[model samples]
Target: MKLTVLVDNNTYIDQYYAGEPAVSYYIEIDDLKILFDTGYSHIFIKNAVSMGIDLNAVTHIVLSHGHNDHSRGLKYLREQYALPNARLVAHPLCFRPKSYENEYIGAPFSLEEINRLFCYQPAEAPVFLSENCIFLGQIPELYSFEKRKAIGTTIIDGAEREDLCLDDSALVCRTDQGLFIVTGCSHSGICSITDHARKVCQDQRITGIIGGFHLFDTDSKLEETIRFLSDLSPDMLYPCHCVSLKAKAQMLKYMDIEEVGVGLTIQL
Candidate 1:
């Protein structure tokens, strides 16, 4: 499997790619071309083009969650690089109205609009995009310290309720060494997502993990996360996006974190 960072919060000094406070990865596994998250705008598309990646060739689009930073680019994709045959995968509730601090943070397009753009595959269970790549649907919060906390609110059946980020998910790539987990802002808790990926893939060895851990503050949760990841001992860790400098500093104390930026690529 080969993965390319199309959009990230940071850009390499000489890479010359556009950077945004968002996340998007272009992954190629076997004959499948998968796009994980879309970032906040059409910037991902522009970066992919610069990298010689053809967005129209994407076979599947997997959304990590319903947050604006992750799903907003779908609108640009639909408007410009329309892939009518591509499969759009996400949790059922990912399209529900989401708000943070009384401001809209959910997907810009409605479910009805999305259905017209791609072959919608709303999954509540693990869905395989390829023989080795699987979408971990609705991660289970198994860790005592990594409990789900309300990020905002979402409307369900016309009733507003705490948005526990039930839609938060991750993409697991089963490599020869172990699983390579890719995530968006891990609102479901990075440990919970990794644990769920292990359970779903039946592989205890995690080779590496890339993408936002959502550890922006130094708290018990961040401390617990550092502890959990230390024990897991993945070969490489790329914590970016929603992760703050303080959190990264604490994480660096426990594990060797690889630098992540736009134009970065990894092979497994």
Candidate 2:
């Protein structure tokens, strides 16, 4: 599998690609070309073009969650390219209207519009896009500390209710060595997501993990998460987007963390 960072919150000094407070990754596994998340705006599209990646060639568009920073780029992608054959894979509630403290922070397009545009495949169960790549749907809270906390509100069935981010998920790629996890903002708790991925993939060994952990402080949760990850001992860790530098530094105390930025590529 080959993965390229199309958009991220950081960029290498000489990479020249534009940076944004978002997340998007272009992944190629076997014959499949998968796009994970879309970032905040046209920045992903711009970075993709500059990185020599053709959006139109994407075979799958996967959303890790419904947050704007992770999914709002769909509008720009639709305007700039035509990916008629690409199938959209995400949780059923991912397209529902979402807001945090009265501010809209959901995907730019509605589920109806998405259905019409691409081969929409709403999943609440693990679905395999290919032999090795699987979308972990509706991550379960497997640990007591990583309990689900309502972020804000979401409109469902004409009624607004607390959004526990049940739609939040991640992608697990099975490799010869172990599982490689890709995620957007892990509102469902990074450890919970990893546990669910292990359950779904039936693989205990984690080769690596990339994308946001939604961790920002040096609290008990962060310490516990670091311990959990340290136990797994993945070869590499690329925690970006919602993760703060302090949290990264704390993690570095126990495990190795790779610097992630736009134009960065990883081959596994």
Q: Which 10-residue window in model 2 sums to the lowest lDDT?
A: 140-149
Reference-based lDDT, residue 163, model 1: 96
Q: What is the TM-score of each candidate against the true structure?
A: 0.98, 0.98
As a whole number from 0 to 100, the lDDT of residue 121 in candidate 2 is 96
Q: How many pairs in model 2 have backbone atoms within 3 A of each other, for residues 3 or more apart or on separate chains, i.e. clashes? A: 0
The per-candidate count of clashes, in order, stands at 0, 0
lDDT by residue (203-232, candidate 1, tens digit) is 899999999998878999999999999999
User: With candidate 1 superimposed using the best TM-score fit, by how many Å does residue 98's alpha carbon deviate from the native?
Assistant: 0.7
- Clash pairs detected, candidate 1: none
Off by over 4 Å in 2: none
